[model samples]
Each structure stands twice: as structure tokens, then as C-alpha cells.
Target: MKQVEVTLNVNGKDTTLTIPPRMTLVDCLRDELRLTGTHVGCEHGICGACSVFLDDEPIRSCLMFAVQAAGHRITTVEGLLNEDGSLSDLQDSFWECHAMQCGYCTPGMLVASESLLAENPDPSEDDIREAISGNLCRCTGYQQIVEAVQMTAKRRREGAANG
Candidate 1:
């Protein structure tokens, strides 16, 4: 099998990998790099289970090729973990808000919402919903996810103001 060497920054670390041209970003992340947090659902970008942060932006990993993201920065659910391996505040908010059920979609939801909060530290409920529009959650009914984003944004803002 032919492979191409690709270099990218993942979770603040430099990564150089060789993958087949046909391999999707999700495959590379999960299979090659062992970042299994990015799920594979539809594999066609509609399900959003393979969502990840590409250079601080939310992108559907299943829709993109691994080589296409070379030199870019990718953030998976593992990246959301704090230095001590504890959950981030946004992660805690997701739990506090009960933003997920079954938890299959939680990682993608966090990637989307975290990217949204990065762009807009204080996001409205509508903004939160719009940010996660591509990601779907069947069990959470969407309300808790929206509230989670809102709550996270509020917490981030408060922290920024205090710090």
C-alpha cells in the first residue's frame, strides 16, 4: 500500500504520520494516532460524529483526507482534557447540564461547542445551537446541549474577566 507522509500538530504536539491517500482524517486520528474520541458514524460528514478542531475551527473529519490537513492543528476530545487529565470546564458543564445520553455524540459536541466558544466567548443559546447545527444528538433532545454551551460560555467569560 502506498502512503504519503503528513505532518500536523495534534493537541499541541507535532505529529508526522504516513497514511494512504484514501484514508480519511478520522481514520488517521483514530486508527493511526489512537485518538478514538473522534467517532465515526455516517462517515459522510452528515452525522458529525467525526467532528474535530482543524486550526481552531470545527470540521467533519470523515469528510476530509488526512493529507489535506497536513500542517494544520487538530484537536480531539483528548485535547479537551486539562493538564492534570481532568475534564475541562466545558466538559464539566456538559456533565452538569446532562448534555448527553449514551455519550456517543459527546466528543463531537464538545469539539463543536469548544470551537464556538473560542470564537465567541459569550455565546447566546441561538449561537450555541447554530454552532452545533452540524452535530446531531438523538438522545439529549438538544436542550441540554444548548444549555451546556451557554453555561460553558458563561463560565469562560467569568474566568477571563477574573483572570
Candidate 2:
């Protein structure tokens, strides 16, 4: 097997690693960088469990090769935190709303929800549903997830208005 060096800007940090060309982005993030918040589910792109942000856009890490991610920004689930190391508003809302049951899909859910909220701060229920439709969750019946996103949006709006 041949090894290639690639630098990935993840979580606002740049990390260079020597890896095989065929290694998936998720594997590189977890195995090499040790950022385990991004889970590996189906290995296929359909599960959405391996979702992450590629240049602030939601993408399936499992479907991309590590070498292919070179020179691009990758934000894993662990990156979606406050600079003070506290949970982000969306994460806190997920916890408050009990949006996760098994936790396997929470990371992807957070990524999807965060991306949606970034584009549409005050998303309606239908908008929320459409945004998160790509990620599947067996627990919480998705209602809590939707509510969590709604809570985060409302809080952000209130914070902006109060300022």
C-alpha cells in the first residue's frame, strides 16, 4: 500500500497525516486524528451517521477519501462546540429536548440541524423536517429533534433582539 500525506483543516486546526489513498475521511478523522465524535454507521452515505461539515457544508465523511479532503475545512461533531469548550446552543437544546435516545445519530443530527439553522435562523416546522430528512433517527421519533432545533433558533433570535 502507498502512503500519502494530507493536511486537513479540522475544527479550526490543521493536521497533517500520512495515510493510504483509499482511507475514508471518517477513518482518518477517528483513527488518525482521534476525533471520535463522528460516528461510523453504515459506512455508506445513506446512513448520514458519518456526517460532517466540509467547508461549513454538510457532507458524508464516510463517502469521501481522506486525500480528497486535502486543503478543505472539515468540522466534525467535536468541532461544533463553543470556544469556551461549552456545548453550543444547538447541542444544549438537544440535551434539553431529549432529542437523542441511543446517541448514535446525535452527531449527524446536530450537523444537519446546525447547517439548517445557519442558513435559516427561523426555520418553520416543515423547513426543519426538510433539513433533517437526510438523517434518520430511530429514537425520539424525530419530534424532540425538531423541537430542539426550534428551541435553538428561538433562543438565537431572542438573544439578537435583546442585544
Top TM-score prediction, candidate number: 2
The deviation in Å at residue 23 for candidate 2 is 0.5
Best by lDDT: 2
Q: Per-residue lDDT for 19-121 in model 2, tens only?
A: 9999999999999999999999889888788899999999999999999999898999999999999999999999999999999999999999999999999
State candidate 1's TM-score.
0.92
- Please state the error at residue 47 of candidate 1 in Å: 1.1
Report lDDT (CA) for all predictions: 0.88, 0.93
Q: Which residues of candidate 1, in runs, are more than 4 Å off? A: none
Model 1 worst lDDT window (10 residues): 132-141
Q: Which stretches of candidate 2 lie above 4 Å from their native place?
A: none
Cα-based TM-score, every candidate: 0.92, 0.97
RMSD of each: 1.4, 0.9
